[model samples]
Target: MESLLECIICKEPYNQSNRAPIILTCGHTFCKSCVHKMSQHSQYIRCPIDRKFESRDLSSLNMNYAIVQIQEYERTGILAKERCKAHEFPIVITCKTCNIDCCPKCIRKHLSHDMYDMEHPTLIQELDNSMNGFEIKIKEYLDASFSAKNRLDKEISELDHQKVKLKKEIEDAFESLMRILENKKIQSIQQLDHKIKEKEDFLKQRLNDVNEQIKYYSMHYDEFQHMKKYYKESTFIDRVVSCRNVLRELNFVQFIKPKDINDNKLRIIVDTTPLIAHSIGSVSFNEKSSSEILMEQLNFQIEELKSNKLIYNKTNPEQKLSLEIQSISNFLCMSENIPELAKMHLIECCCNEILGYSSLKLSDHLKQELSKKIDTESLFDTKIQEYIPTLRSKLKYVKGLIYSLEKIHEKEWEKGLYVLHCLIINENEYDFAELYLQIALLRICSQSFYIINQFKVIDALPLVDLIKRYTKFHFLPSTMCYKQVMSSLRFAYKFVENQMPDFFFPYFKTQYSAYLTEMSSKATENIPSEYPSELLAIFQGLDSSDLHFWKDSDLSKQFLNKVHRFKEECSPWFQALRFVQERGEELSDFELAALERSLN
Candidate 1:
């Protein structure tokens, strides 16, 4: 019974007569038919004892002769019995994947070390344990990853909590500062009130004197008439002229006056340094705001606020202010419409900061994925010590940026916004785009919006894009300018409108048809005419029925004429194009029914 061969799959003994050609290894054996099938699958003999990923060598497995030798005396089982080659024991044979031996006591021990255990243990666990150290390493990596993820979650929670708290504190600061703004303006408010009060006091005094004289005159008129002749000598009884000058002066009745944000700036636009005259509006007052006054007030307020304070650097005041600007959204626009502008500025800056942070974090993923594609030398750039003239010159460029942003606050809407627009129009460089967007966000979109008209060139379509980006602002491009830009760009203005609806929506908002008509009527006579033909054709065709088309359809020319209202053909296709687009619906059930009815 112990001299029997074991099956690779079943791991049990079978009779010699039933034995098949097999390979043996580690005292385990499997049938040749099974081994041959397994060999075809793998380049190296994968241990059936432990079905780990391994190659199978077909040349090494000999099956037919071994099976034939065992079965030669299968009719006489005693003759077929063999001795163990390594030790003096009755022999059993088997394939390499599973072992069978005559020595039962040693078999149990050999089975204990087997990659796939037969009894008292699990085969899967032995196979797993058989892996070279990578399993432990991979397990450790996964564990560490989970721990890190947990830590990251906690960190994110803490950061979100901090963000909320910071936001609250920032709001509290804004609210408090707004109160200060109102409080400070009380002085100006009082000054106007004082002027009105002074005028009233002067008028009242004269009225009181007039009443006194009138009362005296009523009682002493006859006596005074009697003395009029004697008083011709102009002695102690000299008649005093009634103070009618008071009545005349009192005629200057003061009217109530309402001031805008510009009016409040002197008192409310607090700063750490005295604001330069340039910081104020285009229109000047009798008195310019003192730079010292602003500096002292802003410093005190900054110090008054919890640890965060607005301060001026001894060397670079602009850099310091720019940095602090990230702290507050409230900006002092040189215009009267400051509160509205300030609200917009604050929201934009906060959003921008969040965007920058998010993108910076995501940038790492891009670097990892694309690092293989990137150049090792260029990216690593080990030639730092050998800074040639070209590199040295480029290195000097950051100073120029510092210079640019330093005096940025000094610029007003017209000059500043134009400069910003000109700087941002590049489609080539990302760094340029970043700088442009940053500067644009910092500077409100009031003035550059107008200056876009100055560049009526067909190629500078980016101006239209910029206008689209800042849609909330009032920007009215001429119909000609729009035509030129869209025509030159090979895309319709509606393409931009559709892609960037949020930006253009405010300009084309509802309930403004009257205003639009009024503005159109009032527009200058020489409405420039760079007619884009394709746009006209589309609008004309869309106005027609049956949104389908054919090869010869001059829909392009049709769109041009129809859109610009230049001309339209009397074709049925043109008429149909107008019909479907006006409905702005696809071929629906009702439309289908209408089409069939029309055909019938």
Candidate 2:
């Protein structure tokens, strides 16, 4: 009994602190500190009793409150003896029929009940066997839950990583397109400016020539008048004769007019049809990628489990146990069921023991049968055969819609719109269809905003329609949170509605209210200026060549010390610098230069 309350690893009794008993998924209890130490050596904990690997976080392990209670009872001598309420006689016997402890005087009341000595070896062995069986079932359930959770967690993480990758791809595609458009715009403007300058120069030269002619003609007229008024008749006659030849020349000259100036207009006719058709790059999904394949498999498994039901009802005890097991298995698949499920398992075990029936063995058998039902491909196929084709078809159609949307072609835009409308309207009929639709719509809105802001080739009508549909469908407060969804929505709103929605700014402000408050408080507070020991170590280890030339001087140490003491107070900046310093030779010169420039 004493050994039962002690940790196998440390051979110490359980306590509330460091020696607190924690049960692993394998149903083995050990001290918290011992488990923590074991977990440090590996990603998984290998149960010392069964040598089974349980991939559970040490901190998440359930504390064995039962053991704690028992230990406390033992410490207080509460389990040492029990007295009958009426006779005040010591209770040393258990009424097996009633499943209760009783004194000798109480035996008269339970005369027809089957009684056993408290210290009877056979009774003790029976109790231990029953407990062992219960433990086995509990372990099986826990293992299944842990396995399902781990797989789900891994898949979620992979999808998240894929989401980030896809976002970057979209950004890169748009950035490249924007660059091309920018270059074309600059070139067009330059050409237009050059043509205008050429036209202006020609007009200026022609005007100057005409003005010279006018000045000459005016001076000739004035001279003729002066001769007529003041010169001798002979001189005036000679001037007239000289002017006669010039007048004949002027009559044949034909002065420049507006019509003769070649009034051709320069216009830029941009044929955006071809650019719109081909310039925007397409987004695509590899349907057969490992992640996609895994996702499909997981979806199939989840669907199969959800559809599964026990063939029998609770009238039969064995079937009741089976149903309980099935129900627990279903609950265990969910992330939030661990605490509740643990308590339920404990209660079920206690109930089974008190009932004096070996439901544990029955539960174990049912568990195996359930496993086979779930695991056997032929059985699963037979079970879900009716809806398989329909499910596949729906998935394929959704994939096609996603592919068309990703192509970013003007022709496909309507098709994308149609897909979104259908998805939103029939969202209830499909599993994960709403999620896919939401993300796709958000991406479209984001892309539309990019196109309008950068090139204005694509129409904003579709973007506006999409945003309206998104809002009408109440797609805000999406599974993808505000931070992710709002950025795209805000940009789309600005382009379409010309103003941000009331929800946008407030959502962000409220979401980051705490962070903003912290920042505001920090802005007014004095921060520590000295570098932490870890940072100081990193600074000292940095290569001398990477440092400035002044580092070679005798004042280098003093300079470094002074800089460390008072140069800056931003912890994040210091951490980033320390990270860079720690990387040392791993970072390239260009990367280092970029980091330095960023820091500056």
Cα RMSDs of all predictions?
32.6, 41.2
List TM-scores for all candidates, in order: 0.21, 0.28
lDDT tens string, model 1, 1-600? 234445646554543333354554434466655666676776756766765543335545434344434554564564444445444244543323454543443454455343332332454455467764678888999999997887678668767987798778777877886687688678657876776677677657766766776665564555545445454555634333322333344355343232232532223233435524424333222432222333343344334322323332232432333322332211122212232222232222222333322112324443333233222222222221232222222212222232233334443323333332323331121242233333332122212222322332232234333433332223333243222222322222222335444654454333123323333343432222222243224333441112112111253233223322311211222233345446543333444333323322
Worst 10 residues of 1 by lDDT: 543-552
Give residue 506's error in model 2 in angstroms.
Answer: 99
Q: Pick the candidate with the highest lDDT.
A: 2
Clashing pairs in 2: none
lDDT of each: 0.38, 0.51
Off by over 4 Å in 2: 1-90, 114-129, 148-178, 201-205, 208-600
Error of 2 at 378 (Å): 7.6
Q: Per-residue CA lDDT of candidate 2, range 1-600, in tens?
A: 999999988999888778988988878899999998988998888987889998778756777767876886889956435555455456888998998889987888888889899889988999999999999999999999997787678768867987899899989988987898999889978987887788788778878887887887677677657655644455465666666665665566545443355455534365768867775546665657442343344345445435433332223432322232333323233313332232223223332333222224334444344334345322211222233233333333333333334432343444544454444444332423343344445445445555544434235444544444443343332433223333444443344333434545454334333332332231332223233344335444554222222112333333333323322322323343344446542233444334334433
Worst 10 residues of 2 by lDDT: 544-553
